[model samples]
Every structure is written in structure tokens, then in C-alpha cells.
Target: EADTCIADTAVVEVVPLDMTVADSTVVECDSVAEVVVEPVDFSLVDSVEVVEAVDNPSEIRLNWDDVNYIERNTSLGGILDVIVLGDNTEYVGYIIRNNPVSGIRFKTLDNKVHMLKWDDIVIYSRRPLDPEKSILSQSPLISTYTFAGLKPLEGLIVEQDYETGLITIETADGSVQRNSARITNITNRPNENLYTPKRKTTKRRAVY
Candidate 1:
């Protein structure tokens, strides 16, 4: 009778074996479903990275001084970066004016004025003249440069006298006087639009 009872207990345990197999199959199905969803999560992460890349440019800030704090000694001429032709000598100072007797008058930051001749100067501009840029101007008081390679200096025409063939230019940093013979072209400024006004705008919340 004891041996018969032991055999009956073993037969009962067999039912649980089939249930364990069914539970294992369910677990495998769930794992496969999770694997499919994992790719979607990865895609979402990739999309966020792309959005960050696109928005990064908007976050960048550029800084520049609106007014020059350096005290200017000489009243005439704009601050210009000048490069001489032969020695390629570079200078940063006030180009006072084009002197009919002396040439291109320049005053150094140290307060010494120089007469840079028409033939000697390679280029002069507020910044160094880029050799690879389209030169455009809209001033009636045009003073053509003697050298073809020299870029035309565009600024406010402060003074003009056809009799002396002298034209005075009040540059951003200083003043310049040039002969009409050096001037290639001329256009009238009926509206007197020499300088274009520029306004800067930013996102209101970004100001702080």
C-alpha cells in the first residue's frame, strides 16, 4: 500500500511540468516584444541628437565693440590697416588725407603723420582688404586710385573742389584727400545715403 501511494504522488507532479513549459514560452514571447520596442527607443534618441545639432547655431552668441574707446589724437583720417607694395610693410593708424603735394597722409597711433605715396601703398581699408571680394561703392565723389590693384576707398565725401581737383573723404577712422585723376568713376548721391543703418535683434528671453 505504501509503494502504491508513492507512485500516485509522482504522477501528480507531471502536471506541473507541462505548466512550467508553458510559462517559459510566455517569457520568451515577452522578451521578443521588448527587443522590437528597443529599436523605437533608440530611434527616439537619434532624433533628439539631430534636433540638438539643428538648434545649436541659435544658441551661439557673437560679441563686438560698438564704439572705439581708444582716444584719437588727430582729428582727420579713419583708422585703416595699410600694406605697402615693395616691402609689404603693414601699418595700423589714421590715414589723414590724400595730400596733393605729399601723397596719402597717414598719422600713426603714436601721433606721427606719414605721407604714403600712391605708388607705394598696396591696399588700405578699415580692415585689411580681402583680395577675393567684390568691390562695390555708391558715392558720387569718387576718387579713383592710381594703381589698378588698389581697391577704391569708399567713405563720406567731406570736401570736394573741382578747381584744385581735390576730394576730401572722411573715413570711419580718419579723413583722406584724393585727386580726381585717381578717381575712376563718380555717381551723384541725390538722397545722401552714404551710411546704411544696421539694427540687431535677439530673442527677448535670451537678453538676460
Candidate 2:
């Protein structure tokens, strides 16, 4: 026969699982999942380069081509009345009346006044009679060159003349001596007496 047994105390204990099993259990039992996202592609993008405009140099240049400073002499269209003082042989000088001014006159080869104009007059010396021996042929004889622009009875002389006084107030349309005595003041008139020969050829021989 068996003997009867009695009595006692109780104890509780826990067991751990393998590492791979534990990792697998954590992944499978997770309540939420994680994911990695990528950026989207675009059809058009912002430009990186800047563009500038250019200007033309010719548009800013200045022009100053004009002919305003030139002076032109036009004929007034009237008969230029002139007087021949002496014969061609011994014509040293002449006394001119009705001159545009109170001075002597000389002519050029082309019939144009050389130093004087229609408004001015010149009293020039004559060419030498003998060209072979004397150099006087080449000399200039313009003793007095005056103009109406000068003060009345006032004249400028390159050389002095003893026959007549330097300051001779004269009438514009009268004889020299008569005008001299009656001279009081200067007159402003366009009429002038040019001692230059009416024909240009008359002075050609003297120029050479």
C-alpha cells in the first residue's frame, strides 16, 4: 500500500524568445507604416540668364554744315558812268567826280576793280612809260584809297599830294575844285566814279 503525501508552496517564472523572432514579431505587430517620397518633374522652369539692349552711335551726332558767313556782291543794274581824265600817253593820274566815294580807282585785267569795289575808290599811280630801263613799270601808284564809309572830308593817303589839300570836302555830283570849296559835310550816296578803265584790256600791259 501507498503512503499518503501532504503540503506546500507555489512559484511563477517567464521565458525569452530568439532575436530574429523578436524582430519579426515587432514588424508584423506594428500598427503604422513609414515610406520615403520623391520630388516631381517640371515642363518649364525660371530662366537663369539676363538680356540687355544696345544703342546706335550715329543717332546722337550733331551737324553744323552751313554757308551763312559768306558775303556776295550783286550788281545793282545801272549804267556805271565814268570819265577819262587824260590822253593815254601821259596819263599819270586822274581827278574823279561822281565817284561812289572820294578816292582813286584802279582796275584789274578782267575789268573787275582790283583793290577797290563799287562803293570805294583808289587813286593809283600809272605804269612806267619806259619798261626797258626803269623798274617803275612794276611799281604800284595807288596814292590815296578812300571810301564813303569814312568821315566826311576825311581821306587816307598812302602818299601825299602837294597840288590839292588832303581834306577836300566835295559834292558827290560836282567838279573836284567846286565841290571842295562848297564842301560842308559828307554825303551818303551810292553813285561812284571808278578811275579804272571801262575796258579791262586797257590795264593788261601794266600788270605784266
Candidate 3:
């Protein structure tokens, strides 16, 4: 014997998820209905996108029979502190341009510009902590790429050989460009607090 809604007037619908919205919301219905929510604009104001990189250091290491994956980050030598997609949209980058079939261009650090489409990439790199091994013995190299026969980008250039978990690509064009992707996971996690580019120290004394 329980059934409520002896209709007189009813209209309640509130839908607005993500684009930042808040215009109206009031629900106390007795005989008055009017709920419409629609407002979305993910404004990336100023949109910093001025990418420019072509130095190509292409860091890598995590093969040697997997070598326990090693994990302990913080070696910004060529500067890549990268992290892509899978909800981990962190990119303090510099890959400039790695064409494995015309796809892969990252020049971020606020100055945005990220163009990745080797199937949107899943695991690019991770094998650091060996700059003479003194960052308190670092160890971190996970994700040995698992994209088998992944096609569509026409194989232009993709090289990530974490020792033996091979992945070499290059359809043509002097074919032999395998940066593959580096700085795999310099501590990737809801990351984005990067601005480490300040080093000017040189004090050498010799010539006797």
C-alpha cells in the first residue's frame, strides 16, 4: 500500500559533471518543478603551449633480464619527468619530437604541448638511478611495455628495449631512430610540481 507521487507537476534533472558548473539546484517538491543544469567550460586560460626541443638524449635502462625493475627516482639529466594518460596526466617534459610514425611531441613544464599517439602510449620508460649511483642507491624501473602487435600508427619509430622486453619500430626513412621513450617513472603519481632547472656550479683547481 505504499506508492507516492500523486502527480501534479514533476521535472527534476541535474546534470553537469566536470566542466566546472554551478548555476542552480533546489529540490523540495510539493507542486513546483524546474531544475535545469547545463554549464561547462574547462578553460585552460592562456593555455601555455610553446614547445621547442630537439636535443635528443633519450634515456633508457631496465633490461638486463629485468634486473628487479629498480625504483628510486630523481635524476633529471636530460630532463623528462614525464607521465602520460591513464589518469596520470603529469608532464614536466622534453621529448621535443620522437617520430615513430609522426607521433610523440612533448614540450611541457607549463609551456604546454603534448602530442602522443602511438596508441596513446601505455608504458614508455623507467630505468634510472645510475648517474654514478649515489642518490642513496636508487631503484625504480617498472612497466616493461605490453603492447604486442599494436598497429595503426604505421610503425615510424618506437624503441624501448628494457633490456629484453623488446619493442623496436621504424617503418622507414633511414630507419634507425629508437628513443622509444625515457624517464619512465621518475616518481609518477598525481604529479606536477616541477621546475628543477638550476645548476651553475664549477670549481676546479689544478694545473700545477
lDDT of 3 by residue, 23-88 (tens): 654444365544455565554343344434433334666555645323322344322435455555
State which candidate has the highest TM-score.
Answer: 1
lDDT of each: 0.43, 0.28, 0.42
Per residue, candidate 1 scores C-alpha lDDT tens digits across 27-115 of 22212131111111112122221112221133433332443223333442222344344466766666656554456667766778666
Q: Select the stronger candidate by TM-score from 1 and 3.
A: 1
List runs of model 2 lying over 4 Å from the truth: 1-74, 81-109, 112-177, 188-208
Question: Which one wins on lDDT?
Answer: 1
Q: What is the lDDT of residue 115 in candidate 1?
A: 64
Candidate 2 or 1, higher lDDT? 1
- Each prediction's Cα RMSD? 19.1, 35.8, 23.9
How do these models rank on lDDT, best leading?
1, 3, 2
Question: What TM-score should be assigned to candidate 3?
Answer: 0.18
